[model samples]
Target: MNWKIIFCFTLLSMLETSSSSKIYNVDPSGYVLYCPCMGRFGNQADHFLGSLAFAKALDRTLALPPWVEYRYGEPKSVQVPFTTYFKIEPLESFHKVMPMEDFMEQIAPTVWPPGNRTVFCYMPRGNPDSESCNAKEGNPFGPFWDTFDVDFNRSVFYGPLNYDVIHHNMGDAWRDKYSSEDYPVLAFTGAPASFPVQEENRRLHRYLEWSDDIDQRAEEFIRNALPKGAFIGIHLRNGPDWERACEHIDSTPSLFAAAQCLGYRNEYGRATQEMCLPSRETILQQTRKAIKDYSAKSIFVASDSDHMIDELKKEFKRMNVSVHRMPNPVPQVDLAILGRSNYFIANCISSFSAFAKRERDIKGIPSGFWAFPQKPQNIQNSSSRSDEL
Candidate 1:
C-alpha cells in the first residue's frame, strides 16, 4: 500500500469538505436591517413604514433599530430599543435581530464582504437655489435615496458583505430588481418618509402593534378622562419651538403647504402672527364647532402646554362643555386615546397630530384640521355668545 498517495487523497477530501461547509452555512435569504436616523415617535413611525415596505418589496427580513431618546433639556439620542415603546414581533420570525454591538462583533465578520460595500445614502443633497434640483426628477417622492460606497467598518453596513440600498423614493422599479436570495445580507438606514402615506399606514397597522402596556394605559386613560359617549380628540401643538416653526409654515405657505410640510427653506421668513399662533379665541371656536358637529359629550385635549389646557377648561366650562386630558402626560398614552376617539381635530403642521390622524384613518374615524380664521384688525372685543354643548 502507498501511504504517501493515501495521505494526499485524504488531505484533498478534507479541503473539499471544509469548502462545502462554508458554502452551506452561509444564509441565502439575507436580512434587511435598518437604523432610523431621526425624528421622535411620529417621524419614527413614518420611517418604520418605509423600512417595512422596503423589506417586504425585496422579500427580506426586517431588523428594527433603537428608538430616539428625546430629553426636555438635553440633546436627542438613539439609545433605547424600539421594543421598549411598541410590541414588535419576536426576532425569531426575522433572519436576524441583535444590538448594533452584536451585529458588529458576531455578524459582521461572518457576513460582510472583504472589501468596500454599497450604502444607500437616503439623505437628499442639492443646491437650494435650483428648482430642478429641488423637484422630484428620478423618484416621484423626491431624491430621498441614493447609493454610495463605504468601508465595512461603518455602522450602516451592519449586515452581510454584499448589500443593496433601498432608499425612501427608489420606486417600485428599483425594488423589483432584487430578491432575498440575491444577497447574503442587506441593510438599510435613514428616516424613510418618502413611502406612500396610505401604504405606510397599512404596514404600520400590520407590523407595529402597540405594546400591551401602552394599550392598557390608553384604555385606562380613556375610561378615566373621557365621558361615556362619542368624543372629540384635539391635538393642539403650541410649544415654544412649534411657535417658531409655525411662522416658517405661515411665511412660506407656497413652499411648505404645497410640499405638505416635507420641503425645506434656507431662510427663516416672517408671517402673520395669526398664521403662526392661533389665538385662544380661535381654539375655542374650533373646539366648539367640533363638539357641535360630532354631537360629542366629552372632548379630549392633547397639548404640550398645561396652561393652555387649564384655560381651555375654563372656556369649556363657560360653554357647558366637558374637557378631559391625560393625567400622566405621556405622548404615547395621549396618541392611543386620540386614536380611539370618534372624531379628531389636529394642527396641520404637527407630526404628532399627523401620527394620531394616521391611527384614526386606519380605524376609519373622521378627522380634519382646525382651520383658524385670520384675526380681523378691528375685532379687538371678545364676544359674549356662548353656545351650550
Candidate 2:
C-alpha cells in the first residue's frame, strides 16, 4: 500500500512538472501574467509583465498601474476566470487593462482592496469572442466566481510589486509628438508613466527551454538574410492568408484600398479611418525620411512578410540596392529568434507583430511607438522605428 501511494505521488509530480531537464523553483514574488487577451491581439503575458514594469515605475504618490493580480469574485460578475486558463487555488486572474486616453490621466492605487503578489482576476473568453484561445471548453474561469474564493485571494494582494523602466527614452528635441494620456505621467514625480507589458518577456527564459544552439541558428538566419547598413524595417504581418499575401501586393495605394481586409486601419484615424496604413509607397517614403533624419543607422529587418520581403529583394536587386532576408526560424519552430534584436517596426493590427516587438521581448518601458498620425495610443502610435530607441 505504501508503495502504491508513493508511486502515485511520483507519477503526479512528474505530470505536473513544468519541464523535463531542470525544475523551476517558482519565484516567491509570484508571477505577473496577462494571459492571452480578447482581440487576443497581444501576447499571452503582457497584462502581467506590463504590470510588473509599471509597478516598478510608480513613486509613493503614483497610483498603481491599472491591474489586479488574478482573483475571483467582485461586486458583481462571475469570478474573473470562468473563461480563462485560470487554475484556481493554485493560480489567479487579472483586470481589464486601462487605456491612457488623456495626457493628464493619472494611475491611482486600487479601490478594489489590496493584496500582495496574489493572482488578480478577469475573465477572457466570453460575451465578445467566447471560448477562443485559452478557455477550457465552457468552464471559463471555473463555472462561477464563488469557486476558489476560499483558496485564492486568501493570500492577499502584494498591492504592487517592483515595477519600473530599466531604461527609457521617450523623446528628444527632434520628435515630441506623444499625447499625455497615451503613456501619461505617474503619480508623484509625474514623469511619463510606464504602462503594462506582457508577462511573457520576463518569464520567457523560464517558460521556454530553447537551447543555445537554437539561438545560434536563428542568429545565422539573420546574418545571412539581412541587408547591410542602417536600413528601415517594414513589418507587414496582419493578413488573412499568409501564403497568398504576396500575390495581393501592389503599390501602397491598393493596400490602402483593401483597408480592414488587410487587417489594419490607420490607427490615428481609429474612430474615423483617415490615416489607413500608409500605402507601400507612403510607408517607404516615410521610412526614407526617418532614415535620412537619423543617419549612421541601417535597417536590420525581421518579420513574417515573406511576400513583401521577396518583392523588396527583387526591387532592391533591380535598383541595385542592397537588402537582407531578415526572415529567420519560424516563430512556431523556434522562439529564440525573438531574442536576436530588441527593436522593430510593427503593422497596425497584427498582435503577433505587436507582441513580438513589445516590452516582453526587449524588457523595458514603452520606450518608443510607431503608428499613424491619428493612431490611438491604446493600440497604435507613430514614433521612430528603431530610431526611436
As a TM-score, model 2 comes out at 0.40
C-alpha RMSD for every candidate: 12.3, 15.7
lDDT of 2 at 17: 45
Worst 10 residues of 1 by lDDT: 380-389
Instruction: List model 1 lDDT by residue over 1-389, tens digit each.
Output: 59999767745654554312211223345556554544556656665666665555555445555665455664334356555566644333432333333333334455655463333333322553432222223221122222111233222222222222343444344444444444445554453334223332443554456778889998987787677877888887777766766555533442222112222231222223453356787777887888778778878888876436677777777656688887658888788888888888766455567677666766787877655333333322211111000
Clashes per candidate, residues 3 or more apart or on different chains: 3, 65
Q: What stretches of model 1 exceed 4 Å from their correct place?
A: 1-27, 73-78, 89-183, 192-207, 254-276, 372-389
Number of clashes in model 2? 65
Error of 1 at 216 (Å): 0.4
